[model samples]
Target: MSMYVRVKRQDQTVFLRAEASDTFRTVKVALGDILSLVLDDIKLYGKDKETVLEDEGTLGGFEIGNDDVIFWGQRMDGSTFEPASGN
Candidate 1:
């Protein structure tokens, strides 16, 4: 079983799907691929906060479900990517 990770980048949100058996590893790799973040540069946590998983944790242990959102260490700010309109 595989899971999909939805991440927001700039004006778009991208989905990276990988095996549920390899959640953490796959997510780090996907983050690296999509957000240009290296595996070492990524950190993840569930909404519950209790199930905190990091670089060395197993994917199955996380048990990610449908619409289970995860957050990485990528920086997203309006001032950086937003284009300025003529005032």
Candidate 2:
């Protein structure tokens, strides 16, 4: 079954459709396509904004659910942004 996840960055939010088996890399590619961003520069965090979601992991492995909110930010110089919590 397909699910939807909300990817937020600052004031912008994007809803991505995905499956439980979809890898983070796949999601990043989709997000990159939508926002015209470089794949390697995209970084994703879990709901808490502290857990970095690795590219090789699947959504189910991360326990991400339908309607769950994940954070997105850009990677710069091998460092990722500190996302604001409780968005």
Candidate 3:
């Protein structure tokens, strides 16, 4: 089934239509396409903003549901950077 997910990077947000079976890498590629960034530079976080979603993991495996928020940030120098808080 298809579901919507809210992907956020600081104050910027994008809603992506995805399927439970879709891999996190797929989501990253889509986000990269929209943001004009390299897919390898994108990193996705869970709702808690702590857990790093694995590229091979599926949305359903992460328990991501419709309207769920996914935090994203750019990877720099092989280090993960946290996205600025929207608040």
RMSD of each: 7.7, 1.9, 1.8
Give the distance in Å from residue 22's predicted Cα in candidate 2 to where it truly belongs.
0.5
lDDT of 3 by residue, 18-56 (tens): 999999999999999998999888888888887889899
List the candidates' TM-scores in order. 0.60, 0.88, 0.89
Least lDDT summed over 10 consecutive residues: which range in candidate 1?
78-87
lDDT of 1 by residue, 1-87 (tens): 666665443344557776666657667787788667656654555545334467666556666665566554443352222221110
Q: State the C-alpha lDDT per candidate.
A: 0.55, 0.87, 0.87
Q: How much is the lDDT of residue 3 in candidate 2?
A: 95
Q: Using TM-score as the measure, what is the rank order of every candidate, best first?
A: 3, 2, 1
Worst 10 residues of 2 by lDDT: 77-86
- The TM-score of predicted model 1 comes to 0.60
Overall local distance difference test of candidate 1: 0.55
